[model samples]
Target: VRLSVPTGFGHMVMSGWLIEFKRQYPDIALDLLFDNRVDDLLRDEVDVAVRVMSEPPQQMVATELAQVRYVTCASESYSREHPM
Candidate 1:
């Protein structure tokens, strides 16, 4: 099965998990396509797309695989420089 994922997420927290997935599902071929923009599923370019935001098309099916908590942070130098 083909899988399309954002380059950002794959490189961050997701890459390690995907490596485990690859080891488990060695029999199945996984095509990892990374892009910044959302892909058109109808075009058959991507069978599945994983993104941080929920943007599934109306005609397509989407399942909430996981929920992520958000955090807002800034560096000490940046904070001192900005002085907010």
Candidate 2:
């Protein structure tokens, strides 16, 4: 299977479980593409694609995979110098 996934966070998340998947399904092979852009599935020869979006197109076959919480922080000095 050719799987398309985002570079950083998503790659980390997928690696967590894919280790077990490989152990269980040793006969199958997975090709993972780590990129931030959404690929044309058919054109890119990708069987599956994972992405993070607040909203997805209504026409697509989609499922709620997981919800991730993100945190933003800066050093005390940087935070003092720049305020949101």
Candidate 3:
């Protein structure tokens, strides 16, 4: 199977998953493409792609795997001064 994943996520998360998957399914061949550029799914450049976006393309089938949450924090001095 050919998989296209972003650089950071592919390196930190998918690499480990791929290792375990390879261990379990030794017969299946896996090709990984780690790139920041957006790939053309309709053109069949990749069988599957891991993308981070607010919305998926209307023409393609998509599944929501996970959601990213962001946290904002301020230092004590800044918090005291800005009183939010």
Write out the backbone clash pairs for model 3. Answer: none
Candidate numbers sorted by lDDT from highest down: 3, 2, 1
Candidate 3 regions exceeding 4 Å error are: 71-84
Q: How far in Å is the alpha carbon of 12 misplaced in model 3?
A: 1.2
What lDDT does candidate 2 reach at residue 33? Answer: 88
Worst 10 residues of 1 by lDDT: 35-44
Give candidate 2's error at residue 40 in angstroms: 1.2
Global lDDT for candidate 2?
0.80
Clashes of 3: 0
Model 1 misplaced stretches (Cα beyond 4 Å) = none
Candidate 3: Cα lDDT at 16: 84
- Model 3, poorest ten-residue lDDT window? 36-45
Comparing 2 and 3 on TM-score, the stronger one: 2
What is the C-alpha lDDT profile of model 1 across 1-84, one tens digit per residue? 788777877788679888899899899888888875664665757877787775666766778777768877899999999886
Query: Per-candidate TM vs. native?
Result: 0.75, 0.86, 0.73
Instruction: Write candidate 2's Cα lDDT for 1-84 as tens digits.
Output: 988888885567888787888999999999988877754667888887788887766655777799978889899999889985
